[model samples]
Target: MTSSQEQFVQKEIQKISLPSANTMRLLEINSNPEHCLQDVIDLVKLDSALTARTLRIVNSAAFCPLVPINSIDRAVSYLGEKMIVGIAVTESCGKILNQPLEGYESPAGDLWKHDLFTAFAAKEVARYAKNGMEADLAFTAGLLHDIGKPVLSKLLENASKTTIDALDHGEAKDYLAAEKLVSGVEHAEVGYQLAKYWQLPAPIAAAIRFHHNPSEAIEEFQPLVYAVHLGDIIAMMSGYSTGSDSLQYTLDSHYENFFTFSSNELTKIISDTETAFRPALESLAGKEEN
Candidate 1:
């Protein structure tokens, strides 16, 4: 990014609120392999708003529980750690994530759908991963991977065509490079800045920073990063893209080292991602509407 763009991004970052303390703690606990359901429940109980939101989602039409669930413990368990974490993030960052990106030509909610699908796809991809990766962590990482787009979208207004032209002329190898060339910034770096500002977990910050180029991530985080990378591509391939830049980025073949997916398994990942996406969308959308 140019000096001016960098300054603008930093200025804008200051205007955005950091994730809530409950949300930050929730992310940390979710990323811990040793954490149990009680940990999440305990944290949720500390924040009444989040607690109420959790219960609301559990009883929402998406779940359609035969009986209303009044207990925090049961609600957290039913929603799962991944869903709870998602709820927390939505509570904190929904406004930014749900904004329309006139720059990318994507409408409101497009980024949310894309990120949600990517989260599910990354979680599915993690099933085939080695190194004892956490699927829930991957889900969280994928959900926030494109956060920078909202920050940079206005700056990129009307620049999509130039970005595409750069790609065609080989001035840039992929959309990310073209983005930097056209606007002096790319979404990933802008996102990394936001992640750091929010004090998000290191792995998640790394995932946001290096998702488009997994190999650049440190060895410890490479597996998680690759899951998000592949998940991102799969999200776009499934047509949940954020517009103009869709499918314009390159796929890093190095992901093959971290995951092994048979053609059938890949198909199933896409199918499973779609299956999980619908109700989650309905639940969240219903929450927003209400």
Candidate 2:
């Protein structure tokens, strides 16, 4: 990104609200192993909406529990700590993420669907990566990877026609370059700033920053970055993607060598991602109904 774009991105970052205090507390509790299931239950009970959504998702068809989980305690015990935290973060950002991303040509809820799918894919990929990458962290990173698009969409509303046409026509080779050309900054960089402002973990922030270009990320974050990168690609391949730039991204050839999933393994990963994703989509849809 150019100096001017960097300045514009920083200014916009100031305008966006950070994640809620409850969300931050959940992140803290999940990050610390000392916190027990009761502690998470206590924190979640403080927010009625979080509790409701948690139980709703746990009992959704996607999970297919033998018995319906009615209480927060049962939900916590059934889904486990990591998934509870994931649900908290997702619900916290639902308001912002649920909007249409005009710049990316995504209709209402399209971006969120893509994000949710990527989150599931990332967690699955992390399990296969076996590179010390935590599934929860990977899920968080993938869920928020495209967060900057909403901000960019607002910025693009008043932008020049050339930039708008470029993105619309898919003229650029990739979305990142198109974003930089039009808005003076890319979505990944803006996402990085937003993550930092929200006080998210360093690795999560880094994964958002370099998800599209994993090679640029530092060595410490490479594994996590790779997980998100491949996850995003898998989401796109599985037909959940932002419009126009959906096919614009290039898959890193190195992933085949580094992650080394065989043909059958890759097929399983895709199938499992879809299976995990379906329930999440259904659960969220049910939430909308209520």
What are the lDDT figures for the candidates, one per model? 0.91, 0.78
Query: Model 1, 132-208: lDDT tens per residue?
Result: 68999999999999989998887898887888889999999998999899889889999999999998889999999
Residue pairs with clashing backbones, model 2: none
Instruction: Name model 2 segments beyond 4 Å from true.
Output: 1-11, 30-42, 61-64, 130-132, 158-173, 256-258, 287-290
Which residue pairs does candidate 1 place in steric collision?
1-184
Where is model 2 poorest over a 10-residue stretch in terms of lDDT?
155-164
Residue-by-residue lDDT tens digits, candidate 2, 115-220 = 8888889888887775455677778778888888887776666444556467568776666777678777777877877888888877778888999889888888
Judge candidate 1 at residue 61 and give its lDDT: 81
TM-score of each: 0.97, 0.85
Global local distance difference test of model 2: 0.78
Tell me how candidate 1 scores on lDDT: 0.91
TM-score (C-alpha, index-matched) for candidate 1: 0.97
Clash count for each candidate, listed in order shown: 1, 0
